[model samples]
Target: MRIAVAAPTGHVGRHLVPMLIRAGVKPLLLLRDPDRLAPDVRPEVDVAEVDLLDADAVVRAVSGVDALYWVDPPPAGHNPLAEYKLATASAARAVTEGGVGRVVFQSSVGAERRHGMGEIDGLAATEVALNATDANVVHLRCGYFFTNLEYQVDAIRAGALQVLLPVNQPMAWVSPRDIAEVAAGRLLSEEWRGRIVQAVHGPADLSWQQVVGIISEAVGKPLEVERIPEEEMRGTLAGFGMSAEQIDSLVGMSTGFLGGFTPEQERSVHSTTPTTLAEWAYTELKPMLQ
Candidate 1:
């Protein structure tokens, strides 16, 4: 099977290419600059350069593919929603026109709106776009990334871990690798179609403080998790290059996290390998903390 993957250098892409190769699927990556791919990932995957915004280019590039790993780039400047909408729209059009067979969209877990809670409008919009295509679309609603703790790795090393989360919502954190595994299954299998897959944390849900404690223990330090005012999160994020609108959107998203999510139905979907926060801290995130 021929698979086309966009933004194959991003977090999920790092694991996806290898899985695709091992599954005996020919992987073609759509990247702005092919050099961005890791050396090991690049050699095994075919490269194609096509601006996703350009219809003709997308149609040409999307043709004759069995599946697509759609990871639309966050828009340039400040409009993440606009970028998400436009990019997904283009991909949907191109896929329909090109007669692509399957699509595995990398979407956030709570991409739906809840009253006084978190909203996932962007993911919902992407789902609508992908649904319009003739191809079987599997929306992988990925859980909160464990890598979000990367920012705090430095703080953990410094012996003062300041966790900025506002509430103690139980969230199932999943690694990009696990997300890729689920996505690869959907991409490679024609049996499952037109379904939404919520890929969540391996073991179970963990609260913000629990995660902080786990990290502190992993680093062997008595770190402090200082909670900051919710009003300041947007401005604080701006320093990290997030646009004003993105800051707002993310803040709104966090509200959902504080409200909480359920792993009820998704727990039966399979792909649970059972890795915990402490395990990730001791392994993947340990060195970074040091």
Candidate 2:
């Protein structure tokens, strides 16, 4: 049974590769830059060097593999949406042209909407294309990644957390490690067939206020949540030189969340993971601060 992991250097993929190894299954890794793989793991695994943006290349890379873990690489290009569509189209084409039987797509919480989700729309697009195929697919709709806080290193250090969502409203936050575990289970098992939407809701639904308190406790300091206005967020992204479409899409995403756009999949024991904000903060975020 051949299995391959694409974008193996990413947060979840990094964890997924090692988990697959521990399960005694050697996975074929597909990536754009082979050099980015951890030096320690490079000699222990097989790698196919290819540009993910190239559909023909991705098709070739996964051609004979029985299963694949497809996490679209972080959005890039002047138009990230277009880039996302291209990548999804490539993955869809692979299922048809490459003979890959199963795919566990790294999707997001709001992807079920399939429209008006900003950057999440790209993931919805991926879900749409893959769902059209006959191959087994799991739309792993993950929650807001806990790792996103790492981007707040500077902000956290400044004693403030800029949020796009309401501070007191509940929202899901998941660890990437949790996402990898779920993906690995699907890729490793053959019992489940056809397509399904598996939402990863993390350990709990936490409001930004609760999250801020957790981080403050983890770091032994005070932290505050500064709710950034949607239009202001647009200006900030524009200042960062994001494309117009990207800015609108990103602001649109925040607006949706600000409007309390929780996904339809209700929280259940299966959807909830084990890692909590406190655990991730102490283990992952604290170390980054040092």
Candidate 3:
């Protein structure tokens, strides 16, 4: 089967591409810069250089593909909700025009609700728009990314872990590799039909304190947990040069998480992946720290 993948250079896409190849499926990568693809993988698959925001370009790129793996990358200094809507609309148009048979979208948890969801609203909008297309769609409602902690490596190394949410609130966290595995399996199989919503949660629902404890144990250092207030999140993001819209969106997401807006279902036996916090820390997180 031939599958077209958007954001092929992203965190999940980078892992998914190799898995697709191993499963005896061909991947047509839609890349902004084809050179960003690993040199070894380039000769194995087809490449299409196209801007996702351009409906005509996306339509051309997805033409003749059997399936599509759609992942919207983080927005670049614009209204994230509006940007996602445009991208989803473009992809939906392409799927209809190109006659793509199936689509597996990378969406987040709590996308079932329509409002007060900050960045998640974008995924919710994407889900609604893609559902309107003719092709079969599967929404992988993923949880918080464990890799997001990598951004705080410096602070972590200094024995401090900061978060906007309460330290004791439990939230599901998934590894990108696990997400890739599930997505690859879905892309390779023809079992699922129509609209499917699969909650891709991690092995455990852990609190911020629990996660920090794991990290501290892995790093062999006592770590301090600092919970920043919701109001301070805007100023913190703004200090990083994020625009007003971006700040509002990010803060909104944090607020939603603090309000217990994550996936409510138990982890499915079929969806439980092999990777764990300790494994990820020993492998991915530790290497980055050094």
Query: Best by lDDT, which number?
Result: 2
Q: What is the lDDT of residue 17 in candidate 2?
A: 96
Per-residue lDDT tens digits for candidate 2, residues 176-217, read 999999999999999989989999999999889999999999
Write the candidate numbers in order of decreasing lDDT.
Answer: 2, 3, 1
In model 2, the runs with Cα more than 4 Å from the true position are none
Number of the top-ranking candidate, with TM-score as the measure = 2
lDDT of 1 by residue, 1-290 (tens): 88998877777887888888898776998888887877777668788897765667877887898888887675675776777677877788778888887888887766644222323566667777787767787777666777777866666677665444543666667777777777787788888766555554556666767777887788787766667766777667888987777776667776555534554336544635456777777888878754
TM-score of 3: 0.96
Instruction: Name the regions of candidate 3 deviating beyond 4 angstroms.
Output: 262-264
> Candidate 2 — which pairs collide?
none
Alpha-carbon deviation at 285 in model 3, angstroms = 0.7
lDDT of 3 at 199: 81
Summing lDDT over every window of 10 consecutive residues in candidate 3, give the lowest-scoring window.
Answer: 257-266
In order, candidate lDDTs are 0.72, 0.87, 0.85
Off by over 4 Å in 1: 53-55, 114-120, 160-167, 238-243, 260-266, 269-271
Candidate 2 has what TM-score? 0.97
Candidate 3 per-residue C-alpha lDDT over 1-290 given as tens digits, one digit per residue, 9 for 90 to 100: 78999998888999999998888777899988999999999988899999888889999989889989998768875688778777878778888998899999999887887667788888888888889988899999888888898888888989987788888988778899899999988998999899988888878878889998998888778888989877676777778888887877887776876555646455788656768888888888877777
